[model samples]
Target: MGRIVLNGVRKAFGEVEVIPPLDLTIEDGEFVVFVGPSGCGKSTLLRLIAGLEDVTGGEISIDGRDATELPPAKRGLAMVFQSYALYPHMSVRKNIAFPMRMAGLPEGEQKRRIEAAAKALNLTDYLDRRPGQLSGGQRQRVAIGRAIVREPSAFLFDEPLSNLDAALRVGMRMEIGELHKSLATTMVYVTHDQVEAMTMADKIVVLRAGRIEQVGTPLELYRTPHNLFVAGFIGSPTMNLIGGAEAERHGARTIGVRPEHIASGSPDGAPWVGTVGLSEHLGSDTFLYVHGTGLAETVTVRADGEVPLRHGDRVGLTPNPDRIHRFDAEGSRL
Candidate 1:
């Protein structure tokens, strides 16, 4: 059982509190991702759970036992860092065997586990090579293989894909997701990239300034955000927030509509009308930035890839009323 619970957990450095008291529960076999902008304290929280850092207040429990004071080695958990952390001089087989060797496992056991992890990670043919001989993705797999040998109740990942290029990041995302399915082990991942969080997590914990803004499935956060910060941060291209007279007419201090929810055309009585300032054709979809709509900033609309709307052309936009989001003056969802 890999269930982890934090009760009134807080962290402080000298006199300043970084993480205020908070409670969270990560269920067994669940893939949870903590996401936020830089210095949001997502990594700090993960380290608290890993026992690498002690909580300033309250306690932590793993499988129902208090582990607030346990050292990292006694916590029965494995962590994969942003860095590969492999010994360059060691061969792939020996790199994976390092952990088992440190624990004084028998030679036969070490060989067995190394071979099994290698086969699972598609490194069977590369076992004789050194870390210097592999690509970025291959080196990362070796790091994970090292963790797999520990057989911990849970796995913690600290931005494991940030070092790779965009294409490699996408491939590794799928590989990690597949690994979770095959292992059925609880995994907690951390990242600043919302796209990665949306694609890989069973549950997502959105944090900001050391506090959790929300916790729910990807779609839950996407469909109904708790507040303005969440609404603006969770979506790609982000939701357009309109204020002033346009918002006052709707009986809200501010109004929000996603790009995809707004349609572009030349409807005579459309709610918003503006000139297309720029159009980006990305093959699958076209993103149009419209100006002069009498709102706070440029309104972006997601139109068909083949949209003929060009710069200097006037266009009308209508948002689906049912999909409109209203916010109060204090930025809370109404």
Candidate 2:
């Protein structure tokens, strides 16, 4: 329940700059996700906010207080790391209560907070279990619960779901979303998974090479990416990026279109054509990979249901002009 602000934040490891000067405002009780590819500085930014890494320049503030030089504990934030970071020797209850113990809370208040956190995370039955006895997902929950018991001003998650199985990841994602809703606390989650960002975040900060690429809601980034990098990175199956010359001939510098915007056959008001190179039936829809149009690689088109397309099928392809995105030679959106 605190507003977190970063003003001209920067990070560097000796001569190599990791994060360039960046400014972001995270409103109180908002869930903001920082997402990017590996080595793109998302985790670095999270660590900076958590005070795990000191900022090379600029300031970090939480709840109207400047905290640039504060230690991790003094920053009034709890971080749940990717590794869970649970103490293997401690029972679940003890582990979750450790932060309170460190802060010297009275026994009664500590017990009450621990019990409430365990119950909220559905860990009541596993309070006596050690980290060795819990499943990966359970251990992750304990890590989160430990953070919850601290009742910090904000929560920082660094790929907390990366170790879970696919199904567990989905379920835990929902749980985290619910946790945010119920707690109404400021949260900043960093992950390479775009799906996590798209599903959980009220706003997303997309980063690349230590610099921010775009900051917007999931749908806004999906619908209108500001550059080729974001246009290719934000979507499932990714958007198709045709060469500049080819796109310019079609009245655009570089054509970018989503799979769903492309069709298998000649749809009304559609333009561009390519031979269907490969088709994948995904039950609810079909993904057509079209090639041989002077494009760098195959273009994917999402069609409703199966469209009876196959590999090497000579088919005409068309994209909705209104749905097309144009980028300049430098990859900036035109």
Candidate 3:
């Protein structure tokens, strides 16, 4: 019953429109992620849904009820922010009980919910400790425990992991994914990190300059991007794009091939010839940056970690014709 729908939703500040009219739907128990570069309006969209910000036009509905004009507290949703906004003087138990206390729930109900949330987040032993006594990860769990106690219809996460270190971010990411499964609640998360989006989302909405560039599963966007912006942005190390004479040979204004799709040795007739400029061995895979290729200035290739290739070595590259992507002059897929 956590379904949320936005119909032609728009947001603006004075005269500058940050989010153009757009429509999106989040199904019950689905984990949806909004991702893009900074100032892409992902957070703004999340705020609009949370009722933290107002929309300039259109409607927002939660479970078939109009909530566009509802205040944040009345929207039946809980938000976890980038910062762990806990009261330093309060114990973890008190922090979690704050929400229930504000709503004037009975003491017995508050105690029950707090205990349940503490155990679920593995904070039972630490419940008596204050915020100053916990690590970064523990404090974050306390914040989430607070949200869990509220038991809102849906959860809104605004870059919740951004404040943690790399290792902690990874751990929290997995924890949040597990939380969603156990709770079976709809969750809307926002992040600029594509890796996080790829690992956590059931559906990903990619945006740029207030407009959605693509909306699909991680693999869908990776395998078949709608346009050049998507193709160049979705993958790690990025897909190699070549223009000029080489692209014309493929009957396209531009051509794209992912690093993993390019074989080190050319096939029957070599389409690309270069010298290895740099090689990176990451134990599991080797990435080679090839120079002097007639196509692009530099072509990146992913090869076996055991590949015996070194800098300045002459090399040949051949892309799998079936996997090659062609783009028109306007950067649209051909």
Question: How close is each model in CA RMSD to the real structure?
Answer: 1.0, 1.9, 1.6
lDDT of 2 by residue, 1-334 (tens): 5799999999999999999999999999989999999999999999999899999999999899999999999988999989988889999999999989989999999999989888888999999999999999899999999999999999999999999999999999999999999899999999899989999999999999989899999999998899999999998888988875678876667888898986666533435566777778889998888887667578888997758877876666667878989888788888
TM-score of each: 0.98, 0.95, 0.96
The segments of candidate 2 whose C-alpha lies over 4 angstroms from its true place after superposition are 266-271
In model 3, pairs of residues that clash are none
Give per-residue CA lDDT, model 1, range 234-331, as digits (tens): 98888999999988988999989999999999948998899999999999899999999998569999999999999999999999899889999999
Off by over 4 Å in 1: none
Instruction: Note the residue pairs that clash in candidate 2.
Output: none
Per-residue CA lDDT of model 3 for 52-98, tens digit only, reads 99999999999889999999999899999999999999999999999
Cα error of candidate 1 at position 239, Å: 1.0
Which of 2 and 3 is ahead in lDDT?
3
